[model samples]
Target: MSTQIVILAAGMGSRLGRSLPKSLTELSDGRTIMQQQFDNIHQAFGKDAKVTIVVGYKLEYIIDAFPEASFVYNEQYDQTNTSKSLMRALRASSSGGVLWMNGDVVFDPVALERAAKVVARDQSFVSVNTAKVSDEEVKYTTDAEGYIRELSKTVKGGLGEAVGINYVSSRDKAALVRQLARVDDQDYFERGIELAIEQNGLLVEPIDISDLYAVEVDFAEDLERANLLFS
Candidate 1:
């Protein structure tokens, strides 16, 4: 089955203080964040990979720039969060699995190799960074069998931080969709993953990507670090 790719770009991303959508912010190399993400997808999954971008805040700009890719608009983007954005994407997807990422993340293409293997096997996974576990970032801990047991920012004894890259197999998609729909509007997509693990027996593996560079450009400092990958 063809791999379905989703880029969640609906949030206002006011923290980045960019006039355009956060994914449209240009790097020093002159490529927008989404532009780099599109290139990385093509590099890793090939040009045949189907890409769908979730848009809301200034949706027209994103639509106009990447007209070739499909789009899903989250009309309540101002009031909702990633949970709703991701839910919409999941609902719109086919029965096959999906690999998705936050729109602002500029990541190393090498990480996609592991993600591809996991997705090909129909295993749900979350890319993690054991080297960096910030109190503000989404963190996770694995079970005895190495499946994600707890995922959220407030989890105690977190083994690592999730890197804004994740996948949902065909088997677990419906459970995740239900959880995402039941979550509060302000909740991040991680909340739904955690709930799905507890209520639906969704076994999500945590893939370590610490050795690779994947930066979510949430702040100016983060943007600097993301640009350093090209420097």
Candidate 2:
């Protein structure tokens, strides 16, 4: 199946204390997070991979940066959350399968290639990092079989932090959209995945990527930490 990429980049990086959108923030290497993400995806899937970026906060910058990418705008981005932004992007995608990533994440390109290869087995998967997890991370707990049991920021006694990357197959895409439509506007997209896992029997396996460098840039400290790691 063909794999499309959907990036959620609508959030205002209020905690980062930056005027620029988090995805546009430059890494220590001087490439913006979005630029690095595009390069990494290209390296993993080649130039033909269809990429859609959902933009809201400073939409012009993202548009200018990725003129070739398809875009879905979230006009109410300030009032909504990632779930809403993701819904917009998913709705715009053609059916088959999609690899979704949070636009502000930086990671080893190998992780993307691994996720793309392994996701076909289960038709759904989420990358996880067990090496280090802070309380601020979006955590998950897996069942004995390695299927995600619960996923949320408040989930305690979790296995690891989710690396903000996921894959959903065409068979499950409609169901995922339905689940997303049922969630609160303020909910994270993972909330919809949690519901799909519980009610629709969607098997979202966890792909451990702890050995690889991956970080979600949310706050100023996260950017500092990412710079330290990538510098």
Candidate 3:
């Protein structure tokens, strides 16, 4: 079954203060963040990789910017959160699995290359960084079997921060789609993942990428930090 790489770019990105989608934010490497992401996908998976973008805020701009990719519109982009947007992507997917990431995250392409192993095995996983766990970022804890247990911004004694990149195997996609739909409108997609784990015993592995550089470009400081990687 073919795999689809989903870019969740529907948010208004008001915090980043960008008039366009956050993924369109340019990097010092002379590529927009999404372009870098596309390049990384192309490099890692070759030309045959199926790419999809979930667009909402300033959807036209994103569509115009990347006319080659498939798109899904999140009609509730202004009111809903990542959970809803992700649900839309999963619902629209024709592939056996999806490898997805935050549109705003500036990451080393090596992370995706490493993650391809899990995609090959058709396993579900969430990319994580154990180097630092911040209060406002999504954090996670694993079960005794090393599968993800709790996942959210408010998780206590979290092992590390979830890096906003993830995968869902074909076998697990239905459960996630159900939970994402059941989650609160304001809840992040992590909440849906947690619910799926609790309600359906979904076993999601945590792939450690602490050695990598993947920054979600949220605040001005984060953008600076990500840009510094190119400098």
Candidate 4:
């Protein structure tokens, strides 16, 4: 099964307060977040894997940064969240299932490669989870078999943290995007995932990545922590 990579780069870094897009924000090495993410996925998936980026909030920065990849703009990005951005991008570009992921997190390329290997066989979506929890990590609730049950960053209790990387196959990609598009724009990707599992009976599995720390940049403190962790 062929896999494409869709990097969701639409959100405004309202907290970051940078003129450039959040994805284009520079780290220590002068490599932008968008570039690092793109390189990481391409290195793992190989040159054959098609790369498309969903851009909003300083969309031009993303376009200029990654001239090689296809860019899909989200017109309602300010009003919408990541799930809606994903739906818009995937709906516009039809392909085999994609490695749908956030552009704001720092991840290991090898981990993504492992997901691709697993997703190819089952045609099921695979998400990353961690047993370790921090005050900052997004927690998730899963069943005995590691299927994500619920996701919340602020909820008091849950199973584990969602590491923000997902692998979805082409067969169900369209259906999944279509299902999510029907939801309100503010709903998150995990909410859509929960809906798919509950209403549509989609098989969305979880791959625990507790050992691998995924640094997500949400606030100034997060950015500082990521710089320390990834630098």
TM-score of each: 0.98, 0.96, 0.98, 0.90
Candidate 1 C-alpha lDDT tens digits along 33-115: 99989998888899999999999999999999999999999999999999999999999998888999999999988888779
**CA error at residue 48 for candidate 4, angstroms:** 2.4
For candidate 4, write residues 26-74 as lDDT tens digits.
8777887777787787777777777889888888878877789888888
Where in model 4 is the C-alpha error above 4 Å?
134-137, 154-156
Can you rank all candidates by lDDT, best first? 1, 3, 2, 4
The 10-residue segment with the lowest total lDDT in model 4:
122-131
Evaluated at residue 30, the lDDT of candidate 1 is: 94
Which scores greater on lDDT, model 1 or model 2? 1
Instruction: Return the lDDT, model 1, position 75.
Output: 97
Best by lDDT: 1
Greater lDDT among 2 and 4 belongs to 2
Question: Model 1 — TM-score against the truth?
Answer: 0.98
What residue pairs are clashing in model 4?
Answer: 96-170, 97-169, 97-170
